[model samples]
Target: MKFKDYLHFLSYAKSLEELWSAHTEQMANFGFDKLIYGCTRFRTATSLGDPEDFVILTNHSQDYVDGFLRNGLYFHAPMLKWALHHEGAASWRLIGQMMQNETLSAEERRVYEFNARLGVTVGFTVSFTSVSERSKGAISLCASSGQTQDEIDAIWDEHGQDLLLMNNIAHLKILSLPYTAPNRVLTKRQREALEWVGDGKTTQDIALLMGLTSATVEKHLRLAREALSVETTAQAVLKASLHNQMFVMEA
Candidate 1:
């Protein structure tokens, strides 16, 4: 598809699954047959947040993800370092550069060697613009098997601008979608209760509006707290809001 057509289709992605499929296909057209996109709002110096809370989408095999994401090997991934320190697009060749400079640790070298075995030797990383200090979003694109770095670089030289633009737009589009962690998903009633709490509604007021007893309203709030793993209603409200579950109109 043309660039403009792709942009139009991207804007209408209704769910994370649809967005991932569309993005994977688009990247494949550029010779990148494998893609992994991850984002987190809970990043800290010591943690990348709960894996359950991370928005991780990939087209790679389960074994690759198990070794990389599931097993926590991504922490030692060389490209991850580049993504953390840089904004915009960067070539995966940076991995070789760091290795050549003897800057890679043994664990980092192991991660690269593991990737090499799966033909993840050539690709590019795009670090998305973070809206908050604690948040980060990035994608790694891996060329198809047998496609060397030189060939991938040639494609980048010709279509780099277009690739960059598409990825940036996709990142922004994803941020606007409604999503919540699987383990933290609030039920419709729970979300509604939180929405009322976010709007400063008292339990009695919400009970009257929702046609439930104040005790039942309190029960819903309690369940919401449990689901979100928070200690209080206030924390539940804030956490629900962060997940785009509060104050959202039902479609």
Candidate 2:
């Protein structure tokens, strides 16, 4: 593959949309059928109405997008969460095949089923957070229908960080956009926890409701802080509630 060609186009991006548009076209030329792009605002002030906002720029059927929104599929996606939090990518088919071979336990089986029905076949999940805050990072890119793991790994080895940086640039672009109201940026989990926190729930109280531990809740808060460029949870929450970009994120 002409991986170097993408590097050439990378130089022409004057804005976030240009960068993503270029990257999307580059990926298709690289043989991917679909490319999903969305930057997550880790925390938002509650004043922003509604939750998360996602804009799909792919040619994939509307059915795929509608199904994704109707069921709120992004929150429950293990691979998506993993890619966003970690620094690497994985094979959905390998994971799915693992389940088929019974390498995973019952819970794993359930996750695989969910992804399978969602029309996901094979893909690579990769992430980059320019700042220390993971939420302030860019959406992990998943290049689907990759014929082999070698190709997928090569994609990561070459452009993984570049793609991540592109997403980060997109974040900055998002911040520059004018809005009638302030934006609230928060992750799906943080948004949910914030609503509960407003209700006066303890971390433990929130954990049980969200099916996570207090530790995990804290991790989300920490990431949210990093993304929001704030020093404390209180500051993060306050900002999240006000930004128009700070989407409610269907938690």
Candidate 3:
């Protein structure tokens, strides 16, 4: 697809599913058949916050994701380390250089070996620039199996700027949309309670507004807290707002 056409589609996308589907297809056209995009707003010096809070989008196989993300292999990925420290596109040739120099740690080697076994060795990684110290976003574009790093690099030479621009746009658009893991989804009443809390409403006030008893309002608040994995009503409200879950208009 033309670059302008993709940008138009991206600008109008209203949901993560729609955005990700189009993104994966677009990347595949550039020989990157497998892609993993991840972002975290709660990063710290030691951690990327809770896994459940990450904005993760991918088109990789389930097995790959299970090993790379669910099994925590991403923590030791060499590209992840690179992404954390820098911005802009990088070649997977760096992984080979690290191997040749014997610079990889044991854990990092384990991740490399796993990817090599799965034909995930040839690819490029893009680290997006962020203004906030605690926020980071990146993507791994794994080339189709049998493609050499040289060929992938050539593709980058020809289309790198366009590819990078598309990914940056995708990342920004994703952050603007609302997303929550299935287990973190709040019920309608739970959302209502949090919205009221955000608006500085007391339990009795929310009860009157929603036509429910104070006890019922408290129950909804408690459930919202649990769903958001927060300890108190204030934290619940903050978490819900971050996920764009409260006071959203219905389509």
Candidate 4:
């Protein structure tokens, strides 16, 4: 596909799954058959977020995902370390540099070894530009099976700029789509109630605005809080916004 053609296709991705499939296919054309994209908005001083809340899109097998994500080994991943502290693409060769220079910690060595066992040894990590301190997004481009690190780097030397541009654009587009984990989806009425509250409307005002009784509006608000697992309306609004569930038009 032409460069602009891929960008056009990316813009039309209506869901995360569609985006993931399209992206992996494109990466495969460049000899990076496996792609993993992870983003989190709920990062804190000591934690990233609830695992379920992360926007994780990958083409890797379930076993790899289970070990890397579900097993929480991603926290120790060397690429993740570079991604958290910097924005831009970093070659996985940096891992080797760190290892040889004695900069790799024991835990990082274990993480690298774990990834190597999973055939995740050769890749480039792209850390997207950040707009918030608590939000982070990155994509790992893994060489196709049987490809060596030197071959991947040669491809990079040839098309690294184009690859980076594609990923950055894809990341921006993904951020614009509405997203929420299955367990946190809000009902139509629940979302309406939250939207009203987000606009600073009180219970009575929302009830009148939505043509519902105040009791029903309160119930919707209560359910919205329950669905979001938040204790108060403020937390509900924040959570809903974080999930991009607020003020989106249903199709």
List model 3 lDDT by residue over 32-122, tens digit each: 9999999988899999999998888988889999999999999999999999999999999999999999999999999999998888999
Please name the candidate that would achieve the greatest lDDT relative to the true structure: 3
Instruction: Note the residue pairs that clash in candidate 1.
Output: none
| Candidate No. with top TM-score | 3
Against the true structure, candidate 3 has what lDDT?
0.92
Looking at model 4, the pairs that clash are none
Off by over 4 Å in 4: none
- lDDT winner between 1 and 2, please give it: 1
- The ten-residue window of minimal lDDT in model 3 covers 242-251
TM-score of each: 0.94, 0.50, 0.97, 0.93
User: How many clashing pairs in candidate 4?
Assistant: 0
Worst 10 residues of 2 by lDDT: 46-55
lDDT of each residue in 129-159, candidate 1, tens digit only? 8888778999999998888888999999999
Q: How accurate is candidate 1 locally (lDDT)?
A: 0.87
* Between candidates 2 and 4, the lDDT winner: 4
Model 1 clash tally, residue pairs: 0
